[model samples]
Target: MTTKTSDSPLPWPPAAEQLPPHLRLMGIAAAKWVVQPVYVLAKLGAADHLAEEELSTAALADRLKVRCDPLRRCLRAAASVGIFRETEQDHWALTDTADHLRTDAQMSLRDFTVLLGEAPMWAPFGHIMDVMRQDTPAFDAVHGQPMYAHLAEDDELARTYHGAWSSLTEGVMRALTTAYDFSRFATIADLGGGDGTALRILLATHPQLRGILMDLSHSGEIHQGADRAFEERLRTVSGRLPDDVPPGADAYFLKNTLHCLSPDLVLQTLRRIRSEMTRPEQRLLIVEGVVQQGNGFDWSKLMDIEVMVNNGGREHSLEEWRTLLSQSGFRLTSAREVLHPQWLLEAEAA
Candidate 1:
């Protein structure tokens, strides 16, 4: 007798949606409590241990050689945030998101998660006021040295840092290879190419192009499944950028490298590259997070704050890129969207 409608209000305000403003704010502020546990699990290889089957927290603790209670508590907290699942009390299993934290997982972010837990990296978030009030970088203020310099002095930290970057480059390389054409260039020189992954992808995708991977230190391990035929075509060179970038490459790919430096250094680097150009027809491909102007939000804007706190570097708008290129004696010819949040700003000598 009664016809039920598809859209009907069960209650004026659902019980779950009735959280008080302060409690909601508290949940937001308490995010670190959730993430820290996941970081611990990542650092302890818990995901890899759970990859095979669901296990009791006691089993995971035994494998990791830590106390059971604390580990169980951590797992429960992590489960609360969907990283892991608690099938029952004290029993846990990996979720889809948690599976990626496994060391052997493709495009694993475990190293990056570990780095996020490191004091030198996460400490900056607490000192934003200081970073804004003074010219001193938050990382420098907290750690007594710039982030890069600090990493240089500690081999372990440096390894973790580069490993994190390698993970990111690996994840983005597919998007990049598909978005832009490398066949037009005879040789592509990657500036600050960590682990040579990006260059390898480009080389494999475009057989016509050879690549030179340049970095401050040639430490990143070559890709596991690198094309055997293109092995001879790939080369790695080590040196500081803008100065040490291999000369005369048809196109220079500076992927996410400029955002790590100050504007002055970026300009100097651009000028140095400009001087190295053998022909006016050559291009300088600046691959970076070019912030979109206006009310919309983008990851680049958030990263700009992180860069500010860590190294005083700032992400730029397209107009800013155009200005920087023009000032460095190059003309911004084309800004190609290579994947979301990344752009390839192609420029020629002005």
Candidate 2:
């Protein structure tokens, strides 16, 4: 996550680089079709089976429990987009992007891709028009239950859901820890921190920092090894947000939690946290994809639509975040874009 930033100047898009409106429109429509093969490859563990070597389609098919003909087609489709490389006529190997799809690979997106490909998750997008009309979550309309509730009832589904989220937390934490200093605080509380991945990273990085991981419950859901490693300092507390949070922590970390709530709920949650603060020095650090305002396309814009459709959540702009914090009796003191599409919004008692 400690990537280099370009200081050299670069020219803007030249006139020759611009495409015709029709071709651009076609490219946009084709994106949906392109993601299918990538998702299929990740779900089937095809990249993992490749073993970092160019394997014939038949061999890969045997490993994946699929027919050779269709399996070859799938690998070829992914190769076309540079996910995998076709070394020979029927032999394929993982590319740099496809390498990350391997099950055991570091920073793997395989689980996240599988979760996204699940029927319940993507089916809601089909009724996107209706979701926009109703102004309610499409997932709830399609499944007759909220997303988290549906996951909780099924153990396997819940693991997959949490795994997908944890996979993302690793990268985000790396970037954040590098960009900001958490050593100033002796105790840090992670509200709704799924699996305690972020807190584990923080505690490991800052040895002096004691931690608290609070969520709906601390059943078999959290990583036991992480707890045992820092058992003396890291406490797993079960509680709901807004209505409850551990008081007296020097700082409260709410990474990717606020964007899951509506405006009113967010305000209520922040106000509740504000009441818990015993000192003006206590901080609230919210890490999320703060929507950037512009006419051009960006990832947060797309994420905003997805969050709205799936969870009735909206990714807020910086101004909106400031307003929300102000309304909750906290002042937005600092805003830093530690990573692209993700910003660290810091607030203190107003």
Candidate 3:
């Protein structure tokens, strides 16, 4: 799962040079469109087919029930960005990127992209200017309700949103498990570990460790644990982070969960972890993309705007995380970049 830095990410355009400032201003909002083909590909089970062979456009069209020209156009667009590759002029093959879209990949981001480009997810971008003017969730302005509430009651929306979130997190989970040492802890509770995938890896890697996932009662509906080698060592508790965390657990993993919450919500969740920790060895492991504004436009910084539009959440810089961690009585002990935009951040009770 661990790759050299080259595989971690393409080092440049430097990331910023990928687009001009003005283009970025718009592309930042428009980039959700990039997730569309991924969703379509996943729905068509394109990767599943590619697992067997590179497909000719006609074969893909036959499998997907779409016309060849449309399928070819989509393949062309995806391949241009390296999401898929052309094995020959009219044939397409899956890339490493395809792994993330598979249902059973080590770290699947398939579900995540489904929600990213859906109307509700993309609708918020239209209100960013008003959000800047009014200082409110543009989502509420556009949808007449909060994003979560709207999705919570709508099965289809919830499914798509969670799918998109899962897609965004697939690589993160892969990058995190292979890049860190989790053997010292006997028990770890992922405060918002959706399907217990992280727990699955940790349990497999650390046989003595048993990991619990604490999330909403309905979390299983959207983020069910997979039947895997280490699944027996994993368990799920049906509740929110503040209520579901077990007392005296050795570690709490909050991966990408904080990026969608406001600072107050984050503080409250961190406080819950604090209340559960009394032993010196207890800790919190946060995997997120730290914002490095003015210096970089790495994906994380760009994602800050996406969060802002979608949830009113802002990406935190390393300093921001350090301050927040300390505020919750935790001290950051180490930091490592796990992927191109993500960092494996470790903190212990202060």
Best by TM-score: 2
Candidate 3 ranges beyond 4 A from true positions: 1-42, 50-58, 79-109, 154-179, 220-232, 241-244
Across 147-210, the per-residue lDDT of candidate 1 in tens digits comes to 8778768878777777776767776778877776666789888888767768877777788988
What are the TM-scores, per candidate, against the unseen true structure?
0.87, 0.91, 0.77
lDDT scores of the candidates, listed in order: 0.79, 0.80, 0.72
**CA shift of 132, model 2, Å:** 1.7
Question: What is the Cα root-mean-square deviation between model 1 and the actual structure?
Answer: 6.4
Residue-wise C-alpha lDDT for candidate 2, range 1-350, written one tens digit per residue? 11112222211121224666676676666765667777888888987877556678888888888888877777776666667777657777766777778777778888888888778888998878887588789999999998777776777767777778786788888889999988789999898887888898898888899988888763335767554658778887887766878887899999888887889889989998888887877899999987777777677888888788888888998999999999999999899987677889999998
- Candidate 2 residue 189 Cα shift, in angstroms, is 1.1
Candidate 2 vs candidate 3: the TM-score winner is 2
Per-residue lDDT tens digits for candidate 3, residues 1-350, read: 32211123432222557667776667555554555765677767777677667779899889878888877777776665567677656877767876666676666766665566567777787778988887678888899887666876788876666556555565566667678877788888887776555566566657899877877666654334456645566667777644456676788888877887878878888887888888888878988888776863488877888877777777898999999989999999998888878888999889
